[model samples]
Target: MDAFFASVEQLDHPEYRGKPLAVGGNRERGVVAAASYEARKFGVRSAMPSRLAAQKCPNLIFVPPRFDRYKEISRVIRKIFLEFTDLVEPLSLDEAFLDVTNNHFAFPYATQIAKAIRHRIFLETGLTASAGISYNKFLAKVASDLNKPNGQAVIPPEKAEAFLEKLPIEKFFGIGKVTAEKMKALGIHCGRDLKAYSLVFLTRRFGKSGRHYYDIVRGIHESEVKPDRIRKSLGVENTFEKDLLTSSSVAETLTNKILPEFFRRLQQSQTAGRTLTLKIKYNDFTVHTRSRTFPEAIPPGSMEALALELIRQEELSGPVRLLGISLSNLIRPDDPGRQLRFSY
Candidate 1:
């Protein structure tokens, strides 16, 4: 899927087509959930501040998200993916990893399956999707974005080493801003530079993740694509148009606005957890989180009380940018005894 949320909006509302648009909080302090290709040309991007996006593109149209519609469409896309292979691992509503090694279609090449999937998605959903075909998840993920909307890129085993050598460290999966800066300081700016470090040296510097970095740099990711992945947490967060300036305002929003939606999702999923985490992002972009793990599942009405307590514990340094709550250590309604694995 390309510009998934924004594309869906455009498909449903013809007026938004070929125009700079974003789907998310349409406020000065809100964050963009997704940006259309037209918006991307003006330096707008997902997770960017709405105010900054407006500054970049004065005519930018901000539309509230329709998650239910997106989810419905995502299910349609998933159906198309399953037609090819059962070993499909969805990373999000829009993106997934498919192991076409033993596809049901019996395609001669993975690239053929990729093409067919993309074609079927467009035919069924009236939206475009870009695909990447590779031997491993990391390369496939990176290659997927090399081309734009309705395109596909493939990295064969023979070309993997050369492909990685020229790739920038920042573009590699799992490398973030802080890690990229650290790598740059150590003169590790590209895949070739990353490959220069021994496994022991990388582990010494980056802890458990260092080994992962080393393996990916040499095009050796061995993780399997597991299907029917379990969701570890259920959360809902909101960004205000105006920063919440007082403790009272923050608490009120959490109780009156966020909690209802949160509970609705929990009920819909029929999942609950003993651990509740509170997330706060300040206007300055600094974030802090606090969590409490109870011995039992969070009972009805207790979540709000616990959330309020968590809020009281944190010292608000400035006007708050975002407020969210997540419940982890989840157990399904039908099987409360079985605990789901928590993933960060």
Candidate 2:
């Protein structure tokens, strides 16, 4: 789906069509969920503070998020994907990876399937979508975004190298700001530069992620498209609009701000964690994490207790830009080696 939340709002309200609209919470604490291309021109973007977004686009119309409606449309779009193949791995509500190697569709090639899928999406949901088609998951995933708003981009085997060569390292899946900067400093700004390094070197430098970077650079991804993906954790965090500079101010957030999020998710999942982790992300995007294990198992009452206890152990020596707690000691067999993977 293209501009999924904003498109849904526009579909439901004709007045918002082709206008600079934003779909998100309409509060100072809220961030943009999606921004129309019209809004993007003014430096508006997803995750931008709502108040800051308002300053960027003075006339930007904010549409409150309709999660229920978005979920319904997501189901509709996923249904269309299943029509072609069962090998569909949904990435959030708007994006998915479809494997058509042994597909039932009559389409002669991946590009044709992409075009048809885009057409079906627009016809069914009354919205546009962009698609990427390639021989492997890595290339295909990147191809999908090359074109946007009812467009398709296919990276045939011949063009795959050239396509990835010029692509920025950040554009690759799972690579974020911190890793991108690290890679850039190492003279790796794109796939071509990354290819010059050996897997052992990348692995030594970046741990497990180096292996992925090594293979993806050569267009040799072998990851499977999962269907019954179980969520292992449910969490929420806070990024203060202004810096939290004092211990008292930080303590207030653990009790008054962060603990509620853990409790809410704990209640919803009927699960709790014995290990608690505290994540403090600075304005520069640098992060410090601390975790601790407890003897008592997690219960509904213990969720907030664990968060507060974790907060108590933490030393807020400087200003905090973000504060987060995670209850991740979920004991599920499907998740392997998790018992030893305590975050705190």
Query: Each prediction's TM-score against the native?
Result: 0.94, 0.80
Cα lDDT for residue 66, candidate 2:
89
User: Candidate 2's residue-wise lDDT over 1-344, tens digit each?
Assistant: 77888888989999998789998745455679899888888998898878889988888999888888999999999999999888898889999988887788666787778878888888898889998888888888888778886788888888878877888999997798899999999999998999999989999999999999988887878888887666656667777778788767776887887777667656666554567778887655568887777764455555566566666676765678788877665655444544322222
Total clashing residue pairs per candidate?
0, 2
Which residue pairs come into collision in candidate 1? Answer: none
- Candidate 2 stretches with Cα past 4 Å from truth are 25-30, 106-108, 238-274, 278-290, 294-297, 315-324, 333-344
Cα RMSD of all models vs. native, in order, equals 3.2, 4.5
Q: Find the 10 residues in a row with the least total lDDT in model 2.
A: 335-344
Writing each residue's lDDT as its tens digit, candidate 1 over 66-153 gives 9899999999999888988999999999999999888897899988888888888888999999998898999999999999788999
Give the best candidate by TM-score. 1
Per-model lDDT: 0.90, 0.80
Q: 16, model 1: CA deviation in Å? A: 1.6
Q: For candidate 1, which ten residues in a row score worst on lDDT?
A: 335-344
Q: List the candidate 1 regions with Cα displacement exceeding 4 Å.
A: 332-344
